[model samples]
Structure formats: structure tokens, C-alpha cells
Target: MATLLYGPQHDPIHIEDRALAHLKIVIATKLRRNETFTLSWKHPEAEPGGRSTIWIHPSIPLRFVFDEPEAPQINVRWVEELMHTANSSGGIMLVDEVLDIGEIERQH
Candidate 1:
């Protein structure tokens, strides 16, 4: 299965097809602007409020995998929707959930 890696909030934020597209855009824009930030969210696969982070770099690949056929066709429209929801709900997007901890710190 594809790894999503997103959380620590009321709702779960799995890296589904559309979510990944929005993340690609956000990260691309941030990298284009030479800006870095952190975001977090909860994943349904984990307990409620379980959190994690990822470090986003411009050099990171944004290409979708072969199994993700629908991802190739999705557009920024979904990203826009996701942004609106996240912004209004105070939720984190895909890359937003990525953080650099400097070390493999354990979670409680």
C-alpha cells in the first residue's frame, strides 16, 4: 500500500489521491518561493490525535505511482477544495504534516 504519513487532531488526514495533488501544489509553491513551514494532522489508521511530521524539499519527487491512475488526472481544483476545508477546519494537508525532528524521536 502507498504510504500517506499525516496527524494528531480531531479528524484523520490520510494521503488519498486528491489530498496528494493539493500537497504537491502547496509544497511546489513553498519551494518555488523558498519558504518552509510545518503542518500536522491525524490519520484514521492510527488512534485519535496520533501525530507525525514530514520534511518537504523541492527536490522531492511529485510524480504519482503507476497504481495511482486517477491521481494523474486530478487537477488543482481538488487542492483548492482541500485548502478551503483545511483552512476553515484548521486541519493539515499532506506535506504540511511533514516535519524535520532532527532525530528519530519516539512518540508516547
Candidate 2:
């Protein structure tokens, strides 16, 4: 699992390493352009049965930590999907990756 330490409180949001890798790209792109958005996700099974949303801003401190020593192969399609939603008024909604076999094969 990977962890996203966001904002000054540094609340830890656990995500799969591959998913976090993709989210990092989308989040960085938006922040770079000085765009602010919300990230919503369902609480993990270990947590209470509910969902959470956070307002992401450029000024806020954010960090991505991966348990793995190396970063996983990023799925470009997944990033694009995330970027698309990040632009929406509803903001970015965390969803499972729709793996592109062709993309994975190309990466190998």
C-alpha cells in the first residue's frame, strides 16, 4: 500500500501504490497549473463505513509515500481518465483503474 500525506495535519490516506502513482500525476498537473480541486474516496474497509473528501490546493503540503522501494509502472490511460475528472465541477473521484492490456504490454 501507498500513503498520501496531505495538508498541514498530514492526514494519511492509504491507497494502492499503483493507484497513488497515477493520482500523483494528476494532482501534480492540476497543482502546477494553480488549479484547486476535491478528491473523494470511499473509506477503506478498516475504517468506518463512509466516504471522505478533501480540498486540494496548490499551497497545501502534500507527500506520496510508497512501501515498495521502486515506483510502479504508471498507466497513462488511467492518468488521463483522472485528469478528465479532475477538471469536472464535481472534482476527482477515486475509482479503480481500468487496466489497458496494450499499455501494459507496451511498457514491458
lDDT of 1 by residue, 2-107 (tens): 3443233223235556456556665555668765554454565644666655544445443432336565544455556544544443444443333235422643
Listed per model in order, the count of residue pairs whose N, CA or C atoms clash below 3 Å is 8, 0
**Cα lDDT computed for each candidate against the true fold:** 0.48, 0.89
The lDDT of model 2 is: 0.89
Please identify model 1 stretches exceeding 4 Å from their true place: 1-14, 46-49, 59-66, 72-108
By summed lDDT, the worst window of 10 consecutive residues in model 1 runs over: 4-13
Candidate 1's displacement at residue 76, Å, is 5.3
Model 2 TM-score on a 0 to 1 scale: 0.89
